[model samples]
Target: MKRATSIVALALAALISVYALFLRPKENSIPSPSPELLAAARPLDTYDFDLVLHPDSNQLGVTMHACFQNRWSETLPDIVLRTWAGAYASPETSPAASDELYNRCYPNGFSEGGFVLHDVTINEQRVTPTFDDAAHTVLRLPVTNFEPGQWCEVSLRMVLTVPDCLHRFGRSQGVWLLGNCLPILSVYEQGAWRTDAYAAIGDPFVSAVANYNLTLSLPERYTPFTSGIFEHANGLYTTTLHAVREAALLVYEQSVTASIQADGTRIVCIGRNKQQAHKPLQIAKEVLKYYNQTYGAYPYPVLMVAAVPFAFAGMEYPGMIWVGENLYGQGLDDALELTVAHEIAHQWFYALVGSDQFRHPWQDEALCEHAMLHYVRARHGAGAYDALARLRIAAPMQENIREGITPGSPIDSFHDLEEYTTVVYGRGAAMLQALDVHTNGRVDDFLKEYVRRHAFALASRQDFEITLADVLKEDMRELLIDYLDTSM
Candidate 1:
C-alpha cells in the first residue's frame, strides 16, 4: 500500500512540473533596448552636450553621427571630390561649375577666413591624426558605420557674419537662406557618399537633422526673436530657446527695432528699419498662419531673416534662413510674396521632414514648392491661386515629361529657368499637387501627415510615396503612377 501511494505521488509531481514548464513561459525572453545616443543640449542657451564653442565665431555645430575625417576617398577619388570644393585641377570638365568655385575652394582651409571650425570631439571613433592639408575643418566619418539602428550627435558653434558671406555672393546672404556651407559628415547610404542631385553644377545637400538646439549670442541692442520663446534667459538681453518644430534666426543689427507679432510666433516688425519689411512681414505672417492652420507646426525655434546682397535671389540654412534683399525693402508683389511664402513654407517641408535630397531633388524642393502652390490656392481663394498655378503648374502638366527629359542635364538646357525650374520646382510640385487633386486633395492631407510622421526622420521619395499610397484608397494608386510615369 505504501509503495503504491509513493508511485501516485511521483506521477502527480511529474504532471505538475510538465504543466508549469508549458504554462509559465520562459524568463529573460524580452530583448534588450536598442542602442540610441541622443544629442542633448541646454534647451537653447544651455548647451548640455560637449561643445566648447569659440566665443566670437560664426560657425555652428552640426550635431550628427558624422566624424570629420579623410575617408571620402573610399567612394570617389580625392581629386574628384576636391573639385567639388573649388580646388579643381581641370577647369572645363570639372564636376563643379565656375560659379561654384569659391564655395568649395577653401584652399587655405577652414581657418582661412570667416566662420571657421575651432574644435571637434572624437568619442569611440577613429580619425585622421592630422587634418593639416587643405583640411576644410572636415571630420571624415562613416556616420552610419555603427549598428544599423543607432544614432549619434554632433554640434557646431557658428557665428553670424552675413557680410562675409555676402562678399562671396555679391550681395550678402539674404534674410531667407537655405544652403549647407559648413564642414560636415557627408551622408553615407548604399556604401557611397551621397552627392547632391545637381552635383554637376552645384554643391552637395547635407542631411537634415533629427533634433536641433540653437543658442544665439547676439548683442543686446538687437531684439532676440526666434521660432519659440526664450525658454530661459540671462536677463532681458539673452534668452534660451524652448522647443520648436524647425527655426532659423534673424538678427537685424541695423536698428533697435522691437515689435512682436500678435500671435507671438515671430519677432514681427522689430527692426528699427521695419518699414521696408512691413508688407512682406504681413505676407510672411499670413502665410505662416495659413501653413500652421493647414499643414503643421513650422520647423525650428526661429526664422532668422538677415537681409544680404543678392547673387542668387535667396538661400536656406539650418536654424536660420535668408532672403536676398531686405523683405522690408522689397515691394510685396504676388511673385515676391510667393517666393517669400515658398521659402517660409520650407520651414516645415524640408527643414522638419527628412529626405535624400542628393538622389531625389523633387522629394523635398518640388514637393514643398508643390505644396506652396496649393497653399496659395487655399489661402487666397482658388481664383488667385489658379492664376499663379497656370504659369507654373498647369502649363508644366501639359508637357511631354518622359521623352526629352534627361536624368541628369545642365540647367541651361531649358529655354528658361521656368522650364527647368518647373521640372524640379514647378512640375515636380504639380505632380504631387495633381496627385493631391486627384485623391480629392487627399495628397495635401497626406503631405501634412507625411511631415508629421517623418518629423526629423529620413525617407526617400519612394518611402513617402509608398507610405502615402497606404493612406490613400485603392482607386488612388493610378494618380501616383501617372505623375511618376507621365511627362505632361
Candidate 2:
C-alpha cells in the first residue's frame, strides 16, 4: 500500500514538470511598456511643400508655402530662404561645384543641377524674390509691416534640377536622395539671419525646428522613404512632421522589411534584396531599443532606413536615415554597425535635442560617436568596444592632438575632411569620455537629464554647460574649457 501511494505521487510530479517544460505557454521576453507620452514643442515655422518628381528629366516642380511666426520680442520685417541647390549652379561660379562632396550629387557636373525660383507671393500678393547669384544660395523676400505675434506666409514656386549622382540632394542609381532639396528658411540667430554659404567642408546647414506637411506625387513603381508619417493613396504620398529642422525623402525601387519595436514604433528597412535589408533591419531594431532605453522614448511613430547607393556612409534626417549601400557588402561589418549606431544616436542628439551644427558640430558628432561606443560595448562586449575606440577614435584623436588641434572648433575652422573628422568625431568623443571619467560614470545620468530638459529645443553650448552644471551641482564650464570653446 505504501509503495503504490509513493508511485502515484511520483507520477503526478512528473506530469506537472512535463507540462511546465513543454506544454505551458511562454511569456514575452521583453514585455511592451506603456507608451511614453510627451507634448511636442510649439513650432515657430511651418512648411507646406508640394513636389512632383519627374524622374526621367531628374527634375522637381515644387510649390512651397512657408509660414513664420515671430519667436522674438521684436517684429520681423523680412524673411530669408536658403536655396541650397543653387550652390550647384556651375563649377566656374560655385567653388564647391566640382568638389568631391558636391560631385557626389552632381556626378557628371553642376550643369545637371540648380534651383530656379519662378515666382513669390506674400499674403496673396505678387512679390519679387531676390536670388543672390554670387552667393548662389540666398532668396530674400520683404515682409513689410509684419507684426509680432502675427503669422506671415511666403509662397514660392521653383524648379529643382536633380543631379545624376548621390550625396545629400540628388539622384543616384535610379534612386532619388532628396535631402535639403527644398528652400529652407534661414534660422534667425543672435539677432540676424544665419545665411552661411554652402561650404565644401562640413554640413553647412543651420535651421530652427519647423512643422512640415509635404505632399509628393511620383510614379507608383517607387517607394518613398520620408522623414514623417508617410501616407500613400491615390498615386500621391503625403507626410506630416512637427518640430523638425529639415525634411528628407528617399525614393527608391526596392523591397522593404517592416517590423514593430517593443515601444510600438514602426521601423522600415529598404534594400535591393531581402538579405541586404535583413541585417540592417536587425541592427536598427537593437540600436533603437537601446537608445529608447537610454535616452527618452523616440517621439515619432515611424523610423525609416533606406539603403541608397551613395558615397557617404550615412546621413541622418529627422525620422529617417539613409544608410549607404556601400556598407552592405563584404569586409565592412564594423563600419556598418558603427554607422548605423551613430545615425541612430543622431535621432536623440540631432533630432530631439537640436544643436547648432554649423557653429558647434562637435555637440552632436562627438556625442553621437560616444553613444555609439556605448552601444558597441553593450551589444558586442567590452573587448569589441575597446578595439573600436582604438581604431576609430583613439588613433585619429592622438594624431590630431599631436597636431595641436582643438576638438571644439567650428565647422569651417578645420582645413579639410580628414582633420574635421578626426578632431570633431574622434577627439570630441575622447573629451566626452574624459568627462565621464571626471564625473565617476555619472555621464549617463547627466545625458538622460539633459535630453529630458532640452527635448525638441535648440541647445547651444551655453545651454549644455548650464545643464551639465545643474547635474553636477557645480559649474562645469571652466572644467571643460578644453572641450567646448566659448570663444567661438
- Model 2: per-residue lDDT, tens digit, 104-167? 5456655557877787998888887776557568788888887768888889898888766566
lDDT values, one for every candidate: 0.46, 0.77
Model 1 lDDT per residue over 365-418, tens place: 776687677778777888987787888777766765546542123343344344
Model 1, global lDDT: 0.46
Q: What TM-score against the true fold does each predicted structure earn?
A: 0.63, 0.88
Model 1 ranges with Cα > 4 A deviation: 1-121, 124-138, 141-179, 192-203, 210-253, 256-264, 267-272, 299-306, 317-320, 326-332, 397-419, 475-482, 485-488
Model 2 per-residue lDDT at 448? 86
Give model 1 RMSD, 1 decimal.
16.9
Candidate 2, pairs of clashing residues: none
